[model samples]
Target: MEWYLKVLKNYFGFSGRARRKEYWMFVLISTVISIVLSLVDLGIGTFDEETGSGLLSTIYGLAVLIPTIAVSFRRLHDTNHSAWWLLIVLIPFLGALFLLIVFCFDSKEDNQYGPNPKAIPDDNAEIEA
Candidate 1:
């Protein structure tokens, strides 16, 4: 999907705002790939019993860690919050819950982060009269 690729293309971009769709799509695609890679590692016997994670999965996770955090930071910006808010996840149970609530809401219109991604027209999309 375009959303998933767009997130990856942005790579370490932590500035601009990202819509909920962009964030969720990236999460979904990453989860699916991780599951498949884990299964492949299991079939090849490269899965680590000690860490309970496969080598391929571990590698993939490391490769995407920056992009994942960048997207989260942008998502928070979309909600009109600073990237510092992500530190809340370090707290007990309440932190993650708060972020979940934050990410669920729609983006604020033209916030300081950037334009509303939801309203931007895709360059590849053809507009017909």
Candidate 2:
């Protein structure tokens, strides 16, 4: 939940590096919310079976579009890749698979993007003995 909120707080931040935890957690929470919203839309008769999507989810998707792109850009940057690499999704199945693999790659030591997020301690984290 913290990771999700962190990403949202940086909603338009497309220039920094996003650690794997930040990227994946945001994806996980967003997916769960979309599913719940879809179910709610179905119960309210706002779901369109033909299109296989619901009004609430559609609206939610639109609301997250920019943030999604921004995060993807940052994630790619984290891996030392240009944000333009995100366009690889347009190449069909292989492209998406490639992107997924790229996302999974461990963060490279301070590259063109910025310092490694993993090396930076969280500002709100508590110190331990």
Candidate 3:
């Protein structure tokens, strides 16, 4: 939940590196929220069978669209890849597979993108005794 909130707080931030936990946590939580919204829309008859999305779900997707891209870009930066690498998603199955593999790669040492996210201390972390 902290990771998800951190990403949302960054909102349009795309210039820094994103740790894998940050990126994946946002994905996981957002996916769960979308599912819940879809169920709500279904119960309210707002879900459209044609597009397979509901009013709330659609709105939520649009709301997070930019943030999602921003996080992906930052994740790429963490892996030492340019944001342009995201274009590979247009290549069908292979592109997504390639990106999935890349996203799983360990974060590189401080690169042109910025310092390694893992090296930065979290402001919200509890102080050690």
**Best lDDT goes to which candidate?**
3
Candidate models: Cα lDDT each: 0.91, 0.91, 0.93
Over 11-93, each residue of candidate 2 has an lDDT whose tens digit, in order, gives: 89989899887899899999999999999999999999999999999999999888888889999999999999999999989
What is the C-alpha lDDT profile of model 3 across 13-85, one tens digit per residue?
A: 9898998988899999999999999999999999999999999999999999999999999999999999999
How many clashes in each candidate?
Answer: 0, 0, 0
Give RMSD (Å) of candidate 1 vs. truth.
Answer: 2.3
Candidate 1 stretches with Cα past 4 Å from truth are 124-129
Q: By TM-score, highest first, what's the ranking? A: 3, 2, 1
Output the better candidate (1/3) by TM-score.
3
Which sections of candidate 3 miss by over 4 Å? 127-129
All candidates: TM-score: 0.92, 0.93, 0.94
